[model samples]
Target: MPTQGWSELGGRLRAMREAAGVSLNAMAAKTHYSKPYLSQLERGIRAAGSDHVTAYSRALNVAADALSGPSQDPLRVAHEWLVADTPVALHREAGRRVGESLVDELERRVIELRLLDDTIGGGDLIPLVRRELADTAEVVKCGSYTEPVGRRLRIVVGELAQLVGWVASDAGNYLEAERTYLDGVSAAQEAGDSALAGQLLSSLAYQMSDVGNPADAALLAKSAVAGARTASPVVRTLLLERVAWANARSRDREATRRALDAVDDAYEERSPGIAEPHWVYWMSRDEIDVMAGRCLIEMGDPVSAAPLLTAAIDGYDADHAREVALYQTWLAESYARAGELDAARGVIERARSAAADVNSVRLIRRVEAIRRLVS
Candidate 1:
């Protein structure tokens, strides 16, 4: 059933695709939508729904809300407005006390955005995340609150900055990511949270390693570890792994090995009753093994890397398509480096299949690089 605005939405979609110089067939391939189905939608014979809008957003590199014009669903309308430039009423009202409840809502929204990042590309999430960060920061700057609530709000700002930074990095906006991370570090410092500040620095370090600044990355990673000495063991373990990666990128095998050993040692210090940070939930044995394998691959020990990558990939949830594709590419690369050409071809094919529908630019670029290496 086509909505009244379907024709207008269809026109915008067609115009956007043309302006981007993307052919209809190319759009179909990128979106995984049938050519006829897309044509029908573009012709206004079919309605543009949420799934369709998301698909188009990823393929066209636009925000999902931009394509979902004048949505009828109340929830969709609310979300669209959330990501829009509409001013917050609380911020407009002078002398409004910022309460714990509002801070709690902001925290909840930040967590939801983080979870959203796991499944969607940074391209699709950038607008929503940027809006959330801006709104939160404005609230902190404009609204009145006690010192305690102020500290919590700043912490939320730090969390949002971390997310926005990571999302920017994923979208290949290195400079934006760097600036956002530094802002987050400042927020964490204001909140007197060394651990969160360290996390921000380590994230920037990871980005540096990815973008060919391994030596700088090594310094930043070590600094992150030093600054967060009082953080939980798991958090320290995660930071140590970043150190290993930076060293591996630098081709300092001895330094890389030492940092990996430290990772294991820190993880061993975990106690049963100590409260774990919510952000460290994804730091686990499997993640550690995957990082170790990736470091080994970086250090030119493909034979050693293969088994670890295989095991981690085997245990990984397939629903996390971007991660699965990323791991598969590394596994494929390891096989190729080991001269297991047949295995490399097979794994790369699987990687390609897994990444076909995942919208992460990083994963797509990785899969292409592995494809080139294997071929």
Candidate 2:
């Protein structure tokens, strides 16, 4: 049921259609909407999302924002689609053919936003990323795309959701993080991309590990490892590393050792020069070394952790402030254990300073832990 605002917006839409000198049937033909549906939409009996506006604008040779005119109240105009009444029994729209250029543009923007996450931290980029996700989700729902193209679009949406969840976690918004992670998992499954789904699950496992029971965390990691069995060896290796980390946190030394050994085997099995998941593009010897060191530290094996931590810190990019800060904590702890107070203090200071540039609660907590050691 369209309310007063929706009716006003509908009136504007009708005016636009009429000014274009197009019949309802012609508009329906151009926009790929049924004539009856267009009539209902124009008569304020139906509400439309952003994708509908985009399609209609394309048909009328007008801009999308221009189609959503200011005839409605500010709040209604801003979130008109959100106010749409959802049916109790859901029905998914069938996939149709969206333009490749449109998909390509979204893909490019996604990658750029991901890179921004790497340098800027999640706190600053969460709102922008969240808004982008909403916009892209509308495209996935309403744009006409073939089954194959629709699959690709779903993957894009999944990737966006994953990024949003990652950012949310970093910013300490645990609830939002979990919700987006679950949403991404559904999206990945819908796209029939098990590898992506497993990756997202692994991320969720890690997030849960922060505050949940070690057993629960370990189970989540194990599930991810099982689900990604057919994925690339690198992907499997990464997930296995998480398993080791979780087990170590639980103080299951035997389980941690087994997981670590499995990760080693997976790494050795990987073939060189093959393409990897874009999400894991940053994984390398340095990342593995860091995870291994982290697990060792968690298991109270600072003696064994020291060398690995040092190597990882040396090889890590200085520009990655959040990671540098985090890795430095374990490295500092190792030094403190070895009675190298001066060296530990020095590294901890550097880490703390680096962490200041980021807004991650996790890294900030690590920073505080190391500061106590320095004192």
Candidate 3:
């Protein structure tokens, strides 16, 4: 295998192991390798031979080939397949029309992947989601379809691009994430789904806020809301929340408060009769409260943020390690800011414990920031 291949393979292995909740010591035990040996492999200090790869596969409970195979450059493939071709590729394979069954299967797979993302780090999901994008792109380029079918296929492609962009962002590949999100925006526009295009833009804006581009994030988020005037109440609320976050990150308290108020108004306008997008399925009163609390945290009002965060986190699912750790870290930061050092340290321990089994670089960084604060 190429050196780059081994390095990428090492990252995948480490992700899978951590996602499986296996500690390095435990993995070494299972693989019958020394801790130092496994460490070297995971750090890419030493290339993994086939035997070493097999050991990692067995320890992580993944397919051996998944650990050893050459890594595909999904970003390159995406640009080639999605950007270089016509809106819908003209060249088609004979007798290979896109069908409802294929589309249905693809939709199901997308939902499955989204659900998996809730419980695992992006490192674990990046390769799987990228493969889905690549395969779907192939179908879109080669398979013949009616206009309606083609539109649906393009929507699915756009959804996968959003997911790929999300995982890429979580894995700290910001440039790849931005490029993929733009590709999805194009796909959504081509499908004539303004709501989906808005969603993609909002997702990118959220990422920008996280990566310290709050001005750009705020602009893109507001534009998303303006462009998708017909979006459902929930979708509108989600976009509004991103705007709040961006503004908060920019330290514009007035703008942040206004955006937060807009979120509440949009959410209250939600009607039972209106069909919400599947992507917004996780939105709830508590979710909104959490975002509001997070906004307050960003605006340096931990006193106001603490209670909202506490209540929301109190009812959160503990099994979601990354989310739990992230929320707890924020909560801990609130305590530290409020001069409740003991409380902050206590919460930091809980956050650290929650983060122990996860492999998210973002989560780790956030937790460490809080840890440093408390220490």
Residue clash pairs of candidate 2: 96-145, 96-146, 97-145, 98-145
In candidate 3, position 275 carries an lDDT of 61
TM-scores of the models, in the given order? 0.76, 0.72, 0.74
Model 3: clashing residue pairs? none
lDDT of each: 0.81, 0.76, 0.79
Provide backbone clash counts, one per model: 0, 4, 0
lDDT of 3 by residue, 1-375 (tens): 212334456677788888889998999789877777677778854444444666777777788666656543433433343334332233332345677767766776576566556666777678777878877887777677788888988899899999999988877888888999999999899999889999999999999998858999999999999999999999999999999999998999999999999999999888634666667756777788888888888888989888988998897655466787888888898889989999999998998887777767778888899989989
TM-score of 1: 0.76
- Which scores greater on lDDT, model 1 or model 2? 1
Q: Where in model 3 is the C-alpha error above 4 Å?
A: 1-95
70, model 3: CA deviation in Å? 35
Q: Best-fitting candidate, measured by lDDT? A: 1
**Deviating ranges (above 4 Å) for candidate 2:** 1-97
What candidate 1 gets wrong by more than 4 Å, as runs, is 1-95
